[model samples]
Target chain A: MPLPAPSPNPNPAPPDAGMSRRSFLRTSAVLTTGLAALAASLKPLLEMNDFPTMERFLQKYYKEMTPEDMEKVLKRIEAEVEKQYGIRPHVRDLKPMDGVEFVYCLNLTRCIGCRKCVHACVAENNQSRNPEIQYIRVLRLPHGSLDIEKAEHNYAPESVPEKGYFYMPVQCQQCKNPPCVKVCPIHATWQETDGITVIDYDWCIGCRYCEAACPYWARRFNFTKPSIPKERLNPDMAYLGNRPRRQGVMEKCHFCIQRTRVGRYPACLEVCPTGARKFGNILDPNSEVSYILKNKRVFIQLKEELGTSPRFFYYFDV
Target chain B: MLRLVLCTQPRSSLVAFGGSARMRPVEGDALTRAGDPMNSQTRTTLVLTGLILAFLALTTLFISNLPGRPLRQPPIPLVNTNFLDTATVRRSYADLVRAGEDLSDFDCYACHEKGKPPPLRYDTNQNLIVPKEHSDIVMGHGSHGRNNNCFNCHNETNLELLQTRDGHEVKFADSPSLCGSCHGPTYRDWEAGAHGRISGFWDRSLGAAERKACVNCHNPHSPHFPSRPPAPGPHPLRPVATASVEPGPNH
Candidate 1:
């Protein structure tokens, strides 16, 4: 009887195996709810206004781009900057000049900690105003001490060169063996031929490895979309220099690459009331930097024990 | 897989409920135990559905609380931070010369009689009393009033010319060399392009470098740099009001 009942069905459905209408409804409800939850979780990404366009997403790495590619990129950047800030910027990709290596010499004896350089840099470079980004941090330290840990970073007194204190303005050292460049997961930042450690803002993933790796605390991250006043926008821009940065890219002092490459003094150097900041071509023997290195009492590089070999030299006139 | 897990969860929990149901005289067991109006599987499904709904609600609440775009505020005003003291006597002289300004404005003899230099007057304290005509000048040139006399730099024989310590006549434009007469080291540093501000090109082939004169930064009457309020410091994302400098043992 069992043999007769077993028909030649290779795939047999048991009595209770078929899907009921209730079960089907249950499964569909679960599926719909799960899909709704997934959609809800992605709301933030959908609301983002700064999501990259197809062109920006597909743009080549900075070093890999040809001159024609750079030209197009610069033009695109100009258009983007204009659209965002309501001013058409004169953006150019200035190359490091031949027979030039920039070196900065800061006379510690003369720095009054007026912080004019910091503001000048902010005006020159289009740093964010709200949640402000300043390149130079003037540390007010007690006299007869060289320890940076004991330095006051946020000291806002009535006047600078306060009694029993000295000022040291610290920015990017432009290290020859840069730890920031080495630690970047993507090679978004690297040292140029002219000793400027430049970052390709477009290629950066905002991981902030370079920022963390920097010994000088020079690197800054744009956590939000930079809010710059349209009227205050600096039109003279360089691709890897003072060009307005996007949210989540790293930026630091490039020795005012745009000005330095075009044979103009940096805004910071020009704005120093005490004439403390000195910058020149280290390659030229007759340059001011070379003279200071030879004649002035130049001390060890900032955090030289880390072997960063910073191009910035601190000197004493005594 | 979710259904399988959901169905399995209530069996153990239902067993615990069953014990309590049985303890109830008869109505509790009839309502919730094995043979009831609503079966255990249906009851478990309802419980899980309610749970999923609650979880989704909480998740939605959490997502809404996440940080969004910052509220647009009025733009922060830009400040004039170029604090270089470029409005001194030399700056005015340089500006006049560059503009090809009338020489009579600067010519001392235009006010004073020909071949007559103004007599130097001193207060009872022996401090040089600046005349009413040159009341704008505040003389504090050298330490301890050593170089306060007008005849030190200004020539008495000729009102227009200035004489260096070596008796060399120096024009106002070449006053850096005149300052070199006393401040030899500073002048040397300035000549070598180390001292003072040097604008324009560092590479000589590209452009001419403009070295600022001594009086461009320093006031001839008072050479000491006057202290002023510093520019505002960094505005960090997080407001940290704590003092950064802790008096450590090393300091």
Candidate 2:
């Protein structure tokens, strides 16, 4: 007997023809539920890895910020200093002095290698802790001997040059014609109108040409990044004088230009216990240096032959 | 169409019989061949097997011998390594101008040339440049048999015609500190006020810590100490003889 014609159903059952429809529906429901639960659990995992928030917390350079941006930076700097150093700092904005001339005069006969001037200078200038970066050097020489050879400057504690040696402190002479200014490759160093030579730390490329050009041995190059642990740092930093310096750049005694130009004496002059240093305007005929030059009979200048025309002058008791 | 060719092939009978399956197919024998289902199926299987084996062999050879093929290396990028070049020296000159420093006409190279100035000639005499006499005491040069030279104090950059910040040019090194290297004793004395000559009268108000450099006292080129003049004859004599006899009468 011929089988009854099969129903010509255009849409036949799915490939699981042997399984009941309920079984197929149950399998699909379990898969859908599992996928939904997995998606819900992954949402919090993705939120935990927020990268943008981390990038906003880092500090940046001063030139890269605007006035509005700097307020936030200043606040951050204040917070960091408090957290790291346990001290509050007073930050200020300072500018170079205009229309003033600063000159330094050294009395070689009187300097007594006490190194108080050196220490005072370091403190005033906010210098690095390394002893090698000292701005002032007190040399001891033999008495009654004009010969530089007989001079013994390497004195130990009780360093007063033996019975015959005299002391002299050498520093930046604030030359009217500074060779260092001429040699700087980047205009990062310049003599201010006030006669104090200054440097722009940010602008300096650390080529050390200025150090090579200075005649007074007044300039020093920072070989490594300065370390002034935030607590020891003097926050009343001068723009051209004593803000913590960078590595590989040249620096010199600015005659305490920041303080002096503000109508105050340099730290060395203020703290000198022996009154060996004299600071005044050479241009003013009535200034103390001018009076000293006029009244002193035993006055002399170092390397007068080199013609550097240094403002520093010396005198001794006859 | 492919089935018809396989069925017509003489290899179809060889495939069905196993050992004789290597025979080549001949054209124009479709109907009788198709009647034998087993032979057609065997022929089709053999052809498919041969194609797959050829493809795999090619893939294996290509992967194994890849290391023997030549490689192309990328080119190096350019950089500004000319830090000490003439252009840099010239830029230094520009920097001086911006800083407002004056440039003297004295170019360091003019006097410091290798063959022209004569090696080891610091002064006009052409004698080996000697350290200042005091450098011995200050720098311990006496211990070294005076081995140090002007180059020791005045470091040489070995570059010619270095540029200044003002577009003018000068030497690469400065004078005072260069001189200080060998003249350490003198330099220290100058700093401490012991070595160099002092100018001006002493005052109680001005401190002794402010001393001048050695260059301020004796010249580096002709460092001669001025001889002290003899004391005047009318100076006070200590322990003078008293008129003892006349004093006794007055008492």
DockQ of each: 0.32, 0.01
Model 2 over residues B30-130: C-alpha lDDT tens digits?
52366576665455446545544554454444444455443432422211212111111022333454567775423455545654533453445433554
State the displacement of the C-alpha of residue B167, model 2, in Å, after optimal TM-score superposition: 70
DockQ of 2: 0.01
lDDT, residue B157, model 2: 44
Candidate 1 local lDDT, A152-223, one digit each (tens): 878888987677788899999999999999999999999999999999899999999999999999999998
In candidate 2, what are the lDDT values of residues A1-318, reduced to their tens digit?
999997653333444344333323333433444555565455445545323223234533434556666566445544544554566654333444444466666666555555656656666676755424667766555565554444433454333323455666667877778888888776777766777777866567788887777666778778645545554466655556776665666777887755665566676765443445777666666555665566554355656567777777777633
Chain B TM per candidate, please? 0.73, 0.27
CAPRI verdict (incorrect, acceptable, medium, high) for model 2? incorrect
TM (chain A), candidate 1? 0.89
Model 2 misplacement above 4 A: A1-88, A91-99, A147-152, A157-161, A229-231, B1-251
